[model samples]
Target chain A: MLSCREVTLLLSESLEHPLKLRERMALKIHLAMCDGCHSFEKQMFSLRGVAKQYVNGLADELIKCEDELPPPPL
Target chain B: MKINLEKSTKTTSEFLHDGEVVEDLRRQMLKFATQQLGDFHLAEDAVQDALIGALKNVTSFGGRAALKTWVFAILKNKIADVLRSKQKTVNVSSLQGAGEEDENEDFMSLFDQKGGWNHDDRPSQWCDPEASLSQKDFWIVFEACLDHLPPKQARIFMMREFIELETDEICEAADITINLLFVTLYRARMRLRECMDMNWYQRSQNHAELS
Candidate 1:
């Protein structure tokens, strides 16, 4: 019975922490019936997926640089 | 002194000899530091200091976290230190601009009075979102989109997802309450999704049609 707005609000929180059993059930049921919330959920997933890959690649490039890391301090 | 020497020797022989990899680690740490500190010079200093700290306590690193994560943890502290030192004179208005009120407005704007998605603002399916990851220009556009986020939101989002910090740790590092952290992350994701839709996915679909 959760509204689409409420379901989307919980989306990021669900990624961060587990939703309570009732909240989880409500969200599942809402998403099943709500195309807007479903598309919203899929986009959120894809955004995180693409961002992680791109940022990790940047991190890897940083790690693969040719300049030497500074030596440890005395 | 003897133990210190022994630790240094072991750390060097085990991980330091790979000069290129170590350098890359430094660069990666530097990039993370820069994103946190928002200053090239300060980021360099923070990363250098973090490297020194990491090396000094190399033996203490039990490998519970990845090497990159360990170094970034040190860098986070270093960046926090720098921010603290600058806290007295640093401008606060820009950082505090949107506040909770704006976040409520953002939430409200997403839905109709009856709580459904506003028809005009509902999410659209991107064509082959996974395939966009392979395109060369995708990252360029993505980084630009990230840079477009509000400073605080971008920092918190990157800390949570890219740096992979725990929720409590992110709240502590950003000195924000848990509620504020969640709101900022929610907005960041929403904005990033919108940006990618218009700038990357939508454009690519049009390009495919023309070809």
Candidate 2:
């Protein structure tokens, strides 16, 4: 049984790299039983989602400005 | 890849008509450079120089990498040059004990002596986190949290997550080892997570209580 601390560490790493099968199984077993770890994992995913949204919004704003600009001179 | 290869035969002159795209690219470069350099004036000069250099070599830009990434690569070099000239060493070692703020303590406190979630500080279920994405103020707070990170951590985090730079590119640009890069990225994400858990989640509770 992986401890919550260990599980959380793996959770973050899973964002960057694919977990080994052993580590993935251990995380799954732990998360299946632990509500706290489950909630923590969900929070991590949510944070990534929100961060992507914010950055994509910036990209969209820049594109919008480009659209509004006057046509380039020949 | 096939489509890009097909389009690569067109000369740069055919695509150079849009001044607006250049202006927008300049703005993006300045913002990204400022994040990394933490100095508006220096960032401005770096972006200006990068823009001129990019324009001079515009014909050499194959349609391989995205335009933003190519411009950013140049800006990265320009910023590095300025930082090198300033003689400001990037002290990764001192980061461990750099401040009295006790960043290590803050992270440690989240875990119990038994290496499990601390009872009091363990995460709670956040309601409709997706709903907050559409709210403009959420990003304002998010960017504020990003800015609050140590400059080096923030710069690397932005390059990796926001700007979508490859790890190899970031490592080469910053001259950091892979271990240091991973550690810096982990610390940055932890800080940002803690910030959102407190500011966004806790604030919602406070607002509900007020109503």
- How do the residues B56-107 of candidate 1 rate in per-residue lDDT, one tens digit apiece? 7775333322455566667767766665555542233434543443455366
Worst ten-residue run, lDDT, model 1 chain A? A65-74
Compute DockQ for each candidate against the true complex. 0.26, 0.21
Strongest candidate by lDDT: 1
Residue-by-residue lDDT tens digits, candidate 2, B72-110: 667767866664444353333323322323245337778
Q: What C-alpha lDDT does candidate 2 achieve relative to the native structure? A: 0.63
Which number leads on DockQ? 1
Candidate 1: C-alpha lDDT: 0.65
Which regions of candidate 2 fall more than 4 Å away from where they truly are?
A58-74, B1-29, B37-106, B128-134, B205-211
Q: How many backbone clashes does candidate 1 have?
A: 2
Instruction: Judging by TM-score against the true structure, name the best candidate.
Output: 1
Q: What range of 10 consecutive residues in model 1 chain B has the weakest lDDT sum? A: B5-14
